[model samples]
Target: MNVMVAEHIGFCFGVMRALNIAKKTKERTDKPVFTLGPLIHNPQAVHELEELGIHPINSLDEAPGGILIIRSHGVPPDVIEKAKEKGFEIVDATCPFVKRVQEYARKLCEEGYRVIVVGEENHPEVIGIIGHTGGKAEAMNKRRIPVIEDRDRIGMVAQTTQSIENLKLAISYVVERVKELKVYNTICNATYMRQQSTKLLAKEVDLMLVVGGKMSANTSRLVEIARNEGCETYHIETKEDIDPAWFSGKITVGVASGTSTPDWVIKDVVEYIKNL
Candidate 1:
């Protein structure tokens, strides 16, 4: 089996920063550490953190103990407040890029612009961004831009993982009609590089494997890109999940991982395929 790995596989700057902050904070603090959700989507990584006494909790209602670590995607403001009120010191690991989107969305809403969060609804990042806009932020993600005929002032902010091409298409959909248009090109540079490199890799390989947390949006996007190239694609969280049958006949295999993925997981997956 011939295996080729993406040039950009594994942790991007944001995920690295979040992990470092969480780890460093955990090392220093005695208070039990908890993330509002999985710090990154990889169970192995989460389990490692758990070994160090860090845990991920699903809801604020369930979290009345320990220091609360905000995931890479910023939590809702109310969650933060409730955490603080509940006597949990907050270690915010929300990516700066995502924080910027929240700020921009809040600013746009304050200025009376009809805010549109050009991203997935219910995603932690999008949820935080929308909360900033008082829930007026309509989702224009995944090639689904709606008809906007009446808003005099329209503003757009993208989900950090969204592709540049999709962002442009969404903005273009609204540019001509709205008298005032505000676009904060919030697509993080890490996302763009990963997206471009993944697409190129997809074209060159017979089959593609995207590795990351199943809950991770960016990893899912990589799978979509490979599928768009008309190649067989699989989205796996780790080596154990890989089906040998998928690569049974393919000579060339390409592997790409999401920003949140760790390098070791990708390496293990690639090595498994090569050994097969």
Candidate 2:
């Protein structure tokens, strides 16, 4: 059997940056370091951090007082204010591309364009993008994208991990109803590359294996993309999760991973598939 791997699988710049910051924070202080959420979407990575005494807490109320690491998915501004009020040291790891979305959304709101965020409504990145719009942002999920609202002007931005095609579709939907429309293609470059590479590999392979945390938005999207292309795709967290039955009679396989995925995980999966 043949195994094809994506050219752009594994950690992106933003995720790497966030992880590095987390490691340095762990080394610099003895105080408890807590992440607002999993610093990255990968469970293995989170477990690795936990081993280093970096913990993930869901709420600000449960956070420790030492150092709070804001995830790559930027949090609301009020969180920053409140964290500071509690005297917790802040280590921001927000991706620059995400910050760009926030900037565009804020600008649109100030100029009177109804801020339209084209992505999942409750995604952490989507939440952060909305917070930047001064409460004027309206998030359009997969369901909401179809219903064009009654608005004169609309400004658009997407969650960095979303497919560009979805953003364009939402833009097309709004073009007719809104007198003026603006779009910031906020989909991260790495994400687009990963999607494109995955699609290319999926077409040639007999089966597809996607590796990353199930909770990861980008990883889940990869599973959906591969399956939508008519390929038999399985999303797995580790090599142990692979089903041998799924590989029966398959001559070629394609593998791809999310941004938070580690190179070692990909290597291990590739080896496992090759041996089958």
Residues 1-276 of candidate 2 have per-residue lDDT tens digits of 799997789999999999999999999998999999999999899999999999999988896487999999998888888999988899999988888889999999999888889888878999888888767798986687645566667888888998877887788788978678888888999999999898888888999999999889998888888887899999999999998999888899999999999888889999998888
Best by TM-score: 2
Candidate 1 structure quality by residue, lDDT tens digits, 153-241: 89889999987777898888889888789899999989888888899999999899999989889988888888888989999998989
Off by over 4 Å in 2: 146-151
Q: Following a full C-alpha superposition, what root-mean-square deviation does model 2 have from the true structure?
A: 1.3
When superposed on Cα atoms, how far off is each prediction in RMSD? Answer: 1.6, 1.3
Question: Which residue pairs collide, candidate 2?
Answer: none
* Prediction 2 global C-alpha lDDT: 0.89
Clashing pairs in 1: none
Which candidate number would show the highest lDDT if scored against the true structure? 2
Q: Model 1, stretches more than 4 Å misplaced? A: 142-145
As a whole number from 0 to 100, the lDDT of residue 32 in candidate 2 is: 93
TM-score of each: 0.94, 0.97
